[model samples]
Target: MTKIKICGLMTIEDIDAVNQAKPDFAGFIFAGGRHHIDLDQAIKLREHLDPRIISVGVFVDAPIEEILKAVNSGAISIVQLHGNESEEVVDYLHDKNIKVIQVFNPTDEKFNTGADYTMLDSDSGEILDWKNLLIIPDILAGSINSANVDKAIKIVKPKIIDVSRGVETNGKKDINKIRQIVNEVHNS
Candidate 1:
């Protein structure tokens, strides 16, 4: 089954919802965004997160030391990079034995990343044509939710599925929506 990841979590409510929904991954943004969280908050949130649901810290061009700090403090179990980090940067982090999820354009073909996994992101809600990329089992993110999640699973067969605003209402994570999306993804 494809993995489900709920990203951009920002509050205690968001953490509680994730524990209940039990998605494979719960993401906390360390980048610039309305949902961005500070290291202290991420650490507090991680303390409450269920151990079964892995925590991912999302970054864009963050320094290596910051990523290492998060991992060392147990604030995050995985790092998802959405930046211009080079292979050398990746190799540096991988040398620390931390997992990395490198984000790329939907049209990218190089597939030359040294990260543990690569993700496709459109920034817009547009889904990528993922048939040919199935061999890599890369993670997929963009605009995704219950309504179209099953279709995404059928078409992308992504190793991991990511969502942010799609699982929210009024700019806050909705428990019902989260559960619905998780249930749908599991059944798909």
Candidate 2:
């Protein structure tokens, strides 16, 4: 089955919606962006999250200390590195029993970084050419929503489908959009 990941969750309402929608993963961006949340905010939000849903912390070349703080505080269970983090960083996180998802662009020739999982993202709000890409990713992201989710699944056959803006309305996470995308991914 293709699991669903609702990314960039920054509010208790978002967490509440995901709990109802029942996505497999809920992502929080610690990196500076529109959806970014502070450590304190993440901790508070995690309190409302469904225990069955995994929390993914998205970082962009963040310090290991900061990453550890999130995991140790019980805010995030998995780390998704979205920058030029070294394989040693991945190894370090793994040593601490933290699962890691290494993000790579479609233009990158190599995908292996010794992380627990691989995530492919264009980061450009445009879906990648999955068929032309050489490997089947563990997670596929970038402009994914209910409309194109089925096509993405058919082409990539990814283990997880990640969505952020696609599940948003006016730059905020919309419950209806989340539910619609979740249904699409699960049915696919």
Error (Å) of candidate 2 at residue 31 is 0.6
Clashes by residue pair, model 2: none
lDDT of each: 0.86, 0.91
Per-residue CA lDDT of model 2 for 30-97, tens digit only, reads 99989899999999999999999999999999999999999999999999999999899999999999
How high is each candidate's TM-score?
0.93, 0.97
Q: What is candidate 2's local distance difference test score?
A: 0.91
Off by over 4 Å in 2: none
Model 1 TM-score is 0.93
Among the numbered candidates, top TM-score falls to 2
Candidate 1, residue 144: how far the Cα is off, in Å: 0.6
Candidate 1 per-residue lDDT, tens place, 1-188, comes to: 77899999988899999999989999999998899998999999999999999999999999988888988999999998888788888888888888899888766666546889888887666765656553344787878878888887888778888999889999899999999998888777
Query: How many steric overlaps are in each model, in order?
Result: 0, 0
